[model samples]
Target: MNHAIFEKNSLILLIGTLIVVSIGGIVEIAPLFMIQSTIEKVEGMRPYSPLELAGRDIYVREGCYNCHSQMIRSLRDEIERYGHYSLAAESMYDHPFQWGSKRTGPDLARVGGKYSNDWHVEHMRSPRAVVSASIMPGYPFLAQTPLKAEHIEEQMRTLRIVGVPYTDEQIENAQADLLAQVSPEAPGGAEMQKRYPNAVFADSPSKAGVTEEDALVAYLQHLGVSVDFKLYDDKANIR
Candidate 1:
């Protein structure tokens, strides 16, 4: 039998509706808190270094997420095309993860180490030049904009406050590490490597100094290449 009281009163309808919505929300979200295996235990997944973090910030500033996605779904087609499906552990340290919703560009989950740094520079400067059918707009100005790294340490400190695993020494050396990532011959390059073992340095293609383009490229090149898939059974992690 239907409850005539619920239909006859607005306040009763609002309360009943809120109860339904809250139950649905709890059903969806509550399991994550209780489930210990929600995120996989994987090896070789490290947090982003100071320079990579700077590049990630620049990526957000450029609104690259508007067109690109960093995640790869576990469907067979996605695995065939993008190498491996993305892991929750891979982005566990991201304050706001970059698993974008759209794919105007291909999924960037495993784009790291797939192309040379020089190719990335040319493609960013003129996307259509490298991929003739590409409709993406060019970002030539990124190469011209000198990287202002004066506040990089402050940025790292802010990220540390949010649980990004940045150490005191890492935050203190943020500026030098940023410069060292683009200038391998710089005096601090050796120290930077000791701090961030996978950091790669490449000269800016357009300007004399390290530019925003350098940071973005460095960030892109480090994507989806952290976890060593050889150590785990691919089938076990597929989700």
Candidate 2:
């Protein structure tokens, strides 16, 4: 065998490896940018509240990212299975986005207000009660532990730094937004009334449990509530 022929073959192999790696990188990243073009059409998108942001951080820190993805791609099976594919703007505020590829559990991009506080507590305590045959372990610690509210402002600051639009002016508006959507007949509404039946203060902030602190619960409870197959198409109506 010629030594020059062997050297030439090695160079060819190195070039091939670089080409393959480059293609793979582009394949993985290109779609995300394309998806950004579509996000311009999404409506009613907003930043997570301080407490909800805290809960999301907790969700991530607990390795919940290992099991769930925050992204819902545009696809028939994903729409049919998960209710609606997520929009690009939906997760625009997330740093290093939680759009995981592998889902050991479920998609939580829209898990807001899907269940009750008690249910979250219960599910965290024991998954089997809420989800029969769930392989996931219970997070009893989150329930026994009262959530630390110290980082409320700091968390909001972090979200704002990233891109969340929450501001001091928006707090009152957020409360009004929740009130308009929430039905007085709803289970949580009744509980809210029992506590702060009337607006005692024009801008004093809703009761401790009725505002953003509890908005985290509202977010967790409202998951999968927006997409109603009977109401609208899951895909963006953007031209």
Candidate 3:
């Protein structure tokens, strides 16, 4: 236990340092074992549908998280500006959650149903069209680009392996669901509705083919529709 003895012996000092670090690690990590008990369960939260998932991918690919945060901090200012402060249960199904640290644009945690599809379209095609002062870049190419429907099932399967809870039937019908979300004639709209009860589906644009814009808009529209905040009891959710 002599400090001088340990300091004089480098090997013993290394062992002692390891012991201290191990204890610190255990002290910090042991509380996580009770994480399940700490988390409050909200009933309506569901996994993303295929099209929504695709749109999330596009959002990530385009680095939307750099500007728009999906997390709303539980503070008076954030709560007033962004409706309800974001709940942990709302993003329980997200793999690597979109709790971005910066807000170059606005918080999109509750942007769902806030604007019409046409508005979203116009905004995507030209952000300045909707918000005259918007400095955001336009993504007009998304409107012309066709959706990559071929790999929708594969994406769902990959997400399933990572605790997304995508069922076999859902995975099997992923492409169908993606198509149904964007195109009227596409099969599985009813089944998609049944599978993801509150899932959002946008009307197809005037373009004949399903475009990336359809996927992105559908994803954006479904942002905060899962839980009905009107019935959400804050007291019951307090841990």
Q: Write the per-residue lDDT of candidate 3 for residues 1-239, one digit (tens) a residue.
A: 55898979999989989999999999999998968655578878888988898888889899999999999877667777887878888887887899898999999999999998889999999999889999999999998888786887887788788877889988888877887877545677888889988777778676567788988998999999899887763533434
Roughly what TM-score does model 3 have, to 2 decimal places?
0.83
Candidate number achieving the greatest TM-score relative to the actual structure? 3
Using all chains and alpha carbons, the TM-scores for the candidates as numbered come to 0.82, 0.60, 0.83
Overall lDDT per candidate, in order of appearance: 0.82, 0.56, 0.85
Give all candidate RMSDs, comma-separated. 4.1, 8.3, 4.4
Q: TM-score rank, highest first?
A: 3, 1, 2
Tens-place lDDT per residue, model 2, 1-239, is: 55665477988768877999999999998888867454554444446544345555666677777888877777776766766667565666676577887899888876655555656656767889999988899776554454455545655666677666766644433344344323343234433333322211112123333332233344454344433434446356523
Q: Which ten residues in a row have the lowest lDDT in candidate 1?
A: 230-239
How far off is residue 216 in model 3, in Å? Answer: 0.4
User: Candidate 2, residue 69: CA error in Å?
Assistant: 1.5
Using alpha carbons, what is the TM-score of model 1?
0.82
Which model scores highest in lDDT? Answer: 3
